[model samples]
Target: RAASYEEQGVDEIVILDVSATLEGRRTQAETVRAVRARLSIPLTVGGGVREPDDAARLLDAGADKVAINTAAVDDPTRLDRLAERFGRQCVVVAIDAARRLDGEGWEVVTHAGKNRTGRDAILWARQAVERGAGEVLLTSFDQDGTREGYDLALLRAAASAVAVPVIASGGAATVAHLHEALGAGADAVLAASIFHDGDMTVGTVKRALARLGARVRA
Candidate 1:
């Protein structure tokens, strides 16, 4: 799938171990090493990264960037340290936000979306960027797997709070949702279940965004 997407002109690739945070799963350095040996495009790896060493190991294994989530929220300084050692461009912060109907605002979730922290998503995003995160990957739990649409409110709020590029994740049910995300201030849009289940293609989404007068990687 990576090769297919690359051939289709995808701008970048991100491979995350969704279970890494909960079960002590470490970054698959060997796997990444192999993939990097084969591919030329920039690559990002996330999940189970807890410290600066974990981030270093991934970069050593040829990953262009390392994404920190669960651990970064607990110690955002880790991002600063990683950036100091490897440069800010190599550090990407992934923030998983789950909506709370209690009107508490969006709370940051961790452990593969299983654990919810009371911290406000927008505040966290601001802090993450200040800590040297070059980009932020924001996933909306309310929209995950539902594909109704991205949580545009969350995307807009986070984008407004941070200066780094923001990638909107989850709830991309249709090509139009991608357009809405871009219009809402997302630098890029991420679709998992929709593309994984063949509900839509990345190329189709890009074409739709182009038709809507949005700039997308061609």
Candidate 2:
């Protein structure tokens, strides 16, 4: 699947073991090594990044970046430490945010989205960036796997609050949805089922986004 996405002009790929944190297991860096041996585009691996050592192993195994979600919330200062230890460029802070009432804003979720931290998502984005996270992987739990659309309001708020790049995830049902996300200040957008089910092609999406004035790799 990683190789296929590359053939379709995907500039980068994110491979996450969603069960890592919940299961208390380490990231499968060996699998990353296998994929890295066959790919040219940058690869990001997340999950089970509990500390600086986990991030280090992923990098050593050939991952260009390591993403942290539950660990970041479990210890907010971990982001700072990871950035300082691994360099901010290699650390990505993944934030799973669920919409609050009326979709006015969002709150952070941890433990693979099963636990709410009661932390303001926007504020957390700012704090994460300040603590040395080079990028924010923002996922909307409310829209996750729903194929409805992205939470543009929440994305705008989070993106506006941080200077680092924001990678929007979840609820991308179509090419237009991805385009709208980039327009809403997201540095990049992550789609799953839409691509998995053949609803869209990466090359076509990139072309369309470029035509629509989005600064995507064409």
TM-score of each: 0.95, 0.96
For 66-166, candidate 1 gives per-residue lDDT tens digits of 99998898888898898898888999999999887596679998876668788899999998888899999999988888869999999989989999999
Q: Look at candidate 2 and tell me the lDDT of residue 28.
A: 81
> What's the CA error at residue 171 for candidate 2, in Å?
0.3
Best by lDDT: 2
Note the clash tally of each candidate: 0, 0
The runs of at least 3 residues in candidate 1 whose Cα sits more than 4 Å from the true structure, single-residue gaps closed, are: none
Q: Pick the candidate with the highest TM-score.
A: 2
Clashing pairs in 1: none
- In model 1, the number of clashes is 0
Question: What pairs collide in candidate 2?
Answer: none
